[model samples]
Target: GAGWPGLIEAYRDRVDIPDGARVVTLQEGNTPLVAAPHLSELTGCTVYLKVEGANPTGSFKDRGMTVAITHSLAEGSKAVICASTGNTSASAAAYAARAGLTSAVLVPQGKIALGKLAQAVVHGAKILQVQGNFDDCLELARKTAAEHPVTLVNSVNPVRLEGQKTASFEICDVLGRAPDVHCLPVGNAGNITAYWKGYTEYHGDGLVEQLPRMFGFQAAGAAPLVHGHPVAEPETVATAIRVGSPASWENAVKAKDASGGLFSAVTDEEILSAYRTLASREGVFVEPASASSVAGLLATAADGRLPTGSTVVCTVTGNGLKDPDTALAGMVEVEPLPVDPGAVASALELR
Candidate 1:
């Protein structure tokens, strides 16, 4: 069971991190595992949200990026590169800036959210807009990284998974054991694999009494796992998860089978509903893809698969501010009124 101490020591000794990498003080793990009584009440289970939005780059990608960039620096690479829907690029840009390395991000043209794009730009990445989708960009990045001096800092690198496994350790620490079930949205599917690895290692080492069932949800339009093949053209409003072919496909399948987990697809409508529910009810404003976990949980609960009073942990992987446009969809614009007290009282419905 390589929980905190063992995992940290293992990462330091086994992983290929730089000897003296400069990491941001705020760039470590230990994100909040907040209780969501509202969601718990609805599901008849004690539901907890692993709020990864609190990560330094506003997504769980920082966990992986820190390790990936550190390894890149250790290898003496002057530049790092990645293909991202949004979060990965932002993380890479920030970490590269911290490590004093140039970052280059390839993104699908007109696909990424404004805030994510802004983060990459502000962090000084050379952002390239590919004419095709995320898969296309990823392919180009892989080829470019292979042919050039820039290090590929994507989830394809094993070090990223090693770093991301820390989330599982943190969850076990807070809950005192593995929850009955763990759910999360899967894009490239590396996160689920990492969680499974963490949980298995922890259980093997006697840190946890048992392993939790992993549940991975993907956007219906972009679900290669459920569909049993990659989509030629993946589409979803949850831009962060509109992946056609996940790079870590085999490892994700291994996680599902090893943990007795389920892989499912949720519709766009369901994703949006969960997004609003997390925002208004649970008071957790996460990006649409992050809501996919809640969507799966609600669906599984409705199907009577989840037991009452069981502990369920859902990983909300990113912050809502990364995609503010989704939050404003179908909303009416309000006109500003005069700055008078009378106007304020009138707007407040005071007679």
Candidate 2:
């Protein structure tokens, strides 16, 4: 209670953790809503970054995990299971460990980033490397949970989205109204759906006069929502969003249609460009997948799809540390200085 209360306690009336359940929390959520002056100047719109990477697990999944794990424990489930590209598994494992439940994560073999995999491993989750892709692993996790006593903590669970919707509330509360547009990277599509639900709920309650148009961006190589079809082989450098058959497909569609939102695809180059810009220019170090929102913003603005002078919020989903390999790729090796101050000054061109 001394620190910022976790999301559940912060939004007690809204977040539906099960009654009589001890709230399982890592004090996730209440992430920063930071201003992006460079992006605002570039696009002629007031831009803000919902830096979700600040969550306990360095990803937005922790927002939902707290609720899901609390529900799992209340339901008397001794274990929990999930399928993930990377972030979900880490969040689930950490939350499960906190709840004193056995956690099992099914991840695509060779797909998850090392940092995320390490998080799950260190949290003591039973890791199973599936031979198939993420969708396959999710299906397997679903079936296993249905047959066993283990609870499924994936976004497919309604409670997970319930917890995630609080993000929209936080945004609205901070801005005093919904933004004109809300941009985010769409993978499993749960986050977009949750944000839409939250915004609409706020609008329904007269907390805001208008709702934001959702702009969901997917990796070009794995853009099932953009294509309006499931990809058999989804591939992208942004592994977090490398989903083909998104589990929340129908709800995501509804969110898009209802909110007058549009889904688009950005290439890996664009994603990486935005990723670097975020770190180098904005002082925000987010994973490549998280930069997809910024990529979408730039794309939409250039194409005249996004209106100028509008208020926009982009959700950067994960911390850059989640994928150190991507950051270190093609890094230049600098010649070591001979322990000389003059050499350093010469290298800096200050001589």
Candidate 3:
């Protein structure tokens, strides 16, 4: 709401949002733009974290689902369906429950994180584990939505991208200007597209002096952008981004080229290392996929691609709690000790 029209107004003409859709918000936007001293020191750039993990569902997907579900409800739809890697299903299920509408989510079998799967189940979504990858599941979901009365809530639904663009607006409002570069992890690639659109619109309207370069990163094993082709069997330890084909692939490409940005892939090892660094050094614990942004930024900085003192923001899209398994990986377990205060104090590193 900073020097701009209402959230709904920004996308009313650009996207095919439902007519007369009533807003039922959980105050989703306006997330903190926190300065990252550790990242800044590492990159020699002014680094900030757009912490989307603070969203209602512990992920940025909440922003999109709110609009998608609201529009679906307005259109007289009693049920909605989606294919998700993980976070999208969780958000859709929770929002559908809040709206008192039936929701169904198709996910790649055994690929989703435990937390997300639990959320979908607890939110009462009809969860289907398709014996295929996310792309296959998406195809099934699209066919199902077309054949049935259920509305599809994926990023392809336009309303989702409209809502997600608010993140960019929030960043601009907090910084009072667009940063030199915006880095984010890419899964279905919708988030990057929305961010680019938001920045371009803000610049076009004379709200900002210049647009930031849009840098998008994908997990190395799941990176279609870097590969220059779709990977039918995309794999990554970052389960949330284990996507083969991105729905907004062309849009993502356009965003990168139009902004003079780069689309690259970070290895699983690099992603995990960045995650640990964010948690231990930066005090920001995010999901492994979310760490890809920081990973990309560090990589670019080391390669001298990022200019010193440039303002940069990395979008950490999800909370570390979403994938607890990664947090436990390589962690040492402490054995039970006698019920002695001195023993406990010694174990806890008392002087």
How high is the lDDT of residue 297 in model 3? 95
* Candidate number with greatest lDDT: 2
lDDT, candidates in the order shown: 0.89, 0.95, 0.89
Better of 2 and 3 by lDDT: 2
Query: What is the TM-score of each predicted model, taking all chains together?
Result: 0.94, 0.99, 0.95
Report the number of the highest-TM-score candidate: 2
Q: Weakest 10 consecutive residues, lDDT, candidate 2?
A: 12-21
* Per-residue lDDT of candidate 2, residues 245-333 (tens digit): 99999999899888898999999999999999999989999999999999999999999999999999999999999999999999999
Collision pairs in model 1: 1-205
TM-score of model 1 vs. true structure: 0.94
Give the clashing pairs for model 3: none
lDDT of 1 by residue, 319-349 (tens): 9999989998889877798979999898889
The TM-score between candidate 3 and the true structure equals: 0.95
Candidate 2: residue 290 Cα off by (Å): 0.5
Model 1 has an lDDT value of 0.89
What stretches of model 3 exceed 4 Å from their correct place?
1-19, 349-351
